[model samples]
Target: MSDASRSGVTPRRPPPMAPMGKARYRVMMTLVALGLALLAGRIVDLHVFDRSFLQGQGDARTLRTDTIPAHRGMITDRHGEPLAISTPVVTLWANPQDLPEDDIQRLMLANALGQELDALNERIARYAEREFMYLQRRMTPEAAQQVLDLRIPGVHAREEYKRYYPAGEVTAQLLGVTNIDDQGQEGLELAYQPYLAGVPGKRRVLKDRRGRLVRDLAMLQEAQPGGDLTLALDQRLQYMAYRELKAAVTENDADGGIVVMLDARSGEVLAMANQPSYNPNNRAGLDPQGLRNRAIVDVYEPGSVMKPLAMAAMLETGDLPLDTVVDTSPGWMVIDRFTIKDIRNYGKLTLAGILEKSSNIGMSKLALRLDDPVVPAKYRALGLGQSPGTGFPGESTGSIPAPVRWSSSQWAALSYGYGLSVSALQLASAYTAIANEGRRLPPSLLKLGQSPAGEQVIDPDVARRILGMMDQVVEPGTGARRALVPGYRVAGKTGTVRKTDAGGYQEKAYRGLFVGIAPVSNPRIVTVVMIDHPRGDSYYGGAVAAPVFSRVAGNALRLLDVPPDARDPES
Candidate 1:
């Protein structure tokens, strides 16, 4: 039409001659064709090459919460024997915000359970206002399923675990118990909580109206179960020790008794037992008194049994010799009006003789020998009064007062094992240095990465000599007559002390103590026995605690398959 219009309509513009509506239709068709091609490709992927992942995503919505309840690892003994294990049980938990009270209206009473419905209701109800709470723990699987069937609003059955102790009270003090939370609470359980409790994982997915996962989760973390725990306790030995202590406590009418057995060479605690123990399953019945696990927790005047440690300290320091004699007669010695007395007197006794006779005055003399700042330095070296550095939770370190401020009376009293308090575990562990040829390896409840290539606490020769002296203490000396274990040469000492009270030292209260090593050629165990407040007659260590020692030692040696020693019962 016009020259300018013609140039504007050059070949590049295509002149817009075709129907505009038709061109729009062509573009629409092209877009529709591309979309169809994409759809076909997706369909091919869904039905063929990668159908599982996509189909799984769709299935996740209905079955999203599929879970696997992994078994908690078992706690085994050093021998790979089961000490504690997880037994599956159903725990009842509820979303308190949605639960109806009618679901748990009453707790059914089962004689074995020991709890009433009313009590159950109260315990759970206390936490009911909270969003989440445990309604019950460790219920039977069948009972759990029944509760689940009720399908009460917010009421759900959670599968959990209950700790089962195969040896029951025999290993209770060491294995410990867990709370309702399926968590470890005390003893070894507390010690290994982190490693023994596993990492819990989670997954999230869309669910259908029926609560089944219909689509695969965008988030799925596979749960890793807990690692198994191995303990240092020997179940059989523990049971034997427990039985021995229980029998002795009942027979002696003692207020309480403690028995500790140590692996003489390794310093590993083989067994530790106390009387008046409660079944862990019924922990609610445990009294503060009953709950007092005395082996590690209790500290008392160790009496004459402490002489060996004191004597070992002096000998190891090369400051005192076994033949060094001290005058210990008159059955008493007065230092500044505070008299230190022997339960029985020996006129003149060597350091070894003092321990053999269990002479308090004799041990007092030895403590006096070491009373020089340089002497009891060996006492400090032996780890007395310090915590055993043992890994056991709640263990008491015991007390050894600094002799730096030693009053004559305190120093004298400390000599014969009064004023200075020691735990059975500490004493046992310290003796390990002697039995281990003078090395004090840190005691442990778990296996060590490296054995306590330990610190030197004594001269090897001195330790050997001490062992021999201990043997004689059980052979023909004061600690002898009662601590006779057939077939083994046992070496140890006896101690009898007036139990102190809040008012003052109890005039009549006594603690009978005995500590010994067996198979003297190569000591196997360091066993210590302590009996408190023995009633009626025969309260001496030789009379009360020694018999306990004899029974425990005899059984322990035999159980260990220790070869018989050269000892004549008649002799």
Candidate 2:
């Protein structure tokens, strides 16, 4: 101001303003141009180079790829009866993060899912970080729809299939049961899982904020439905066997029972039933013991039922004939501190008489005469000590001790159906060799288009003679009298095996068994019955198991319309 006042008339006035300096103006324009260039590069990079990445991030929020479930195959009996079927079901799931926090909505969702509100809240809290969680699996379609109608956020339903068994408990152990994911858990279902479980397909879809599928994005893959399975079981015969086995178990006050019926000509398992069986349709209260297929899996000392097999093996050596007599006087013999006895001494007994009396002494004598490895070899040839090759899960290869190291006492025990074990299926299949006239066919649970090739295990003539000897078991005063059918020529053996406990054989604990072939003239079927721990005075095979065989086989034969082979005296 002093300089201006001195230069001009006013001291506050300053020199006149001049144009902006070139350098300063250039600096300002350069900064503005740099900012614009940076902005333009950023716009190009976002719209071009990183475009797909950003799109993926955005799609991840609302788009989902789902699984398209394939239906499982149907399991049918020989007559086309549905043993197992698959029905459409739905699974409810949710995302905890997307679920509403409102208490009322949460309560409604919990009720729909059959869960308590507190439990649901706790589950949600526990899975708070998870994007998906199962609410209910395998719910009925209507129930799942009820859940979806509520339209709670983050809740969803997925289509699936559930297995249903039409035969219920009758075929429970045979057909087995599946899991909530339609995977086989046991029985034939597990054995054939590869064929029964189809490959699941995939799909891509868009979902809304509430987790509902809004549109089909793309078809990722096509689901392949499983193939069907036809078993050799006859539904009618299965029902009958179940009924008879259950009745016998109840009547004898026994712990459990099993019955297996096979087509003698084909080795087809026409009927197999076990008591303490569960309902495949409802597995809520299933006991592990009840899930066992006893006929195919349970092993036991077969008692006198093995006598015939021993006789057949000895006869094969040409050293013993059907009618060869053995002196059984005094009824009992002792070997190596083990006493082998008969009910009574019949001075001398032919092979047939030994079987008829269920004579342990006579059979033991016969077994002792055989050389080592003879008995076990014959048993192996008859499908004992090996799996039946039916592809059944947990199929047992019954124990048969090698004869190489066996003592005379052990051999004798083997003769009278001890010192070894045999499943009901193995015993029945062994008898089928006799019924099939020496041709032993491997057992099959699946229906066969033709009779399978069989191994010739015994002489046809020897088998016929054994059949005749077995027929004598059903005659009056024989051990298996109760196994007689009024109008059929029945051939069978009776067994009363002492159960082995921790120390040794328990006298009162016995397994009664009967293995028979009906219409012995031609031998159409082989039926085997085993009753476990019969608790009454009459625990013999003839009294407990033979009656079941009589009822089941007799009725089964008639139902199949096989003409009676025995002449009716009244007619």
Candidate 3:
């Protein structure tokens, strides 16, 4: 007490204990309890009831949901040779927000990305809000590795797949091509996209601050790989056809060309090729014209090739026999204002001889003698003016004028294949019916385990007679004599049609076409070759297209091990 008095007067006496009251103690205790209860409630709510919010906040910075890519299906030939494949590739990307701010660091990154520094900076600025941007897509693994070696921050590489065509330009027109995202763009690839495309999967994963994957959380969906497509194509036959067709086009200085080979018995497309093709892998300067599958998409007047179908129509009437004679004296006949003529006058000839010589006037007279609907009906039944149902994109169904509206000249023009148009594929399919004994089987682009039932378009007897008549077309002095293969009896028809322009038909331009079947005795394969606007010494089908057919058919037969049905010419 004496020391307190000396320090301060107010400290002399300690204030009497002012809070000995129970009510104040109870009130303080109650306030402390309420504060503790609120704290515990908030903690429980955060840990249990509202835990998702906290979890989401954490995941926003450290977790990502990523796409698991699925590879497109492999396209293989009938014998399992790869035609189209998916190769593993790398896609280099960057996070603009996390990219180095230093200009020197950015310059290094640009050099690694093969981009100008200014351009890289501009791109980053444009996509600053976006955390991810593609720096390079579809890069080789080596290139991606080189990019990763730079050790640039915010740069990343992801696994992807690129579509590659092993056959290159050889199968380009038939197999079509895929886009950067592996979606089909043209040809059979587009037509069968559903079957060839895969279902992508999804997964969640934890990532570090630097955006590297730290742990896989869960798989949201399983990826379904696309089903492999086994096409009816025979790679050996395809190569042979492509080589021969390309050679023929170059030799003739032609505009373009197409070659189609079919299994006569099974109606499966063995090989289909087009000239002016492009490499599907590199499409830097691809031409739209070259992208067309000319065999199925381009149509032209079949010229004299329709004569055999006309003859078959006449034979079906039971009034005209294979030996029935028609007089063609003047080499030309007037139909309205137009004149139908042959290259030379053959005074009188049987129906078979008419086809052998490709006599336009003779065919015109035979068509006039028949009822109006006969020829058109026969053509329709043979799948003319209709799609072959091969599932090829952009396939053309050629035009066929109605028979009821035909004038005398129109009917005559129809007889020699002038007014109506037909694709090379349609011509080959029609010839296939003849080879298959009047049974018109549907053409297929996929491998067939068994031969499909064919519709009977003509009587088997009539079909056989027509086939025999066509056989003579490959004999000496016949139009398509060059279509013959050694040790094989080839039957076929030749067509030379004038190319049409904006005004009308062009006199100098012609489409030379030959449709044939090999080993006439067995008729195993049907092949059609078409050369567009041949500018060489000859533009006739026999001279330009027949040789291509011969080479392709001969090689295909040998490769297939088809037995020779006739004595070898040398033997």
Candidate-wise lDDT, in order: 0.74, 0.89, 0.89
Candidate 2: RMSD to truth:
3.2
What lDDT score is found at residue 109 in candidate 1?
Answer: 24
Note the residue pairs that clash in candidate 2. 1-11, 5-10, 5-11
Q: What is the TM-score of each candidate against the true structure?
A: 0.79, 0.93, 0.91
Candidate number that wins on lDDT, 1 or 2: 2
The local lDDT score (0 to 100) that residue 366 gets in candidate 1 is 64
Task: Single out the weakest 10-residue window by summed lDDT for candidate 1.
Answer: 104-113
Against the true structure, candidate 3 reaches a TM-score of 0.91
Comparing 1 and 2 by TM-score, which wins?
Answer: 2
TM-score of 2: 0.93
lDDT by residue (1-97, candidate 3, tens digit) is: 6876788765445657566676788899999999999999999999999999899899899999888889889999999999999998999998889
lDDT of 1 by residue, 457-540 (tens): 788888888788887777653546789787778878788888887987888789888888887777888888988888858788
- Identify the leading candidate in terms of TM-score: 2
Worst 10 residues of 2 by lDDT: 10-19
Q: What is the Cα-based lDDT of residue 49 in candidate 3?
A: 97
In Å, residue 132's CA in model 3 sits off its true spot by 2.2
Clashes of 2: 3
Give the total clashing residue pairs for model 1.
23
C-alpha lDDT of residue 307 in model 1: 69
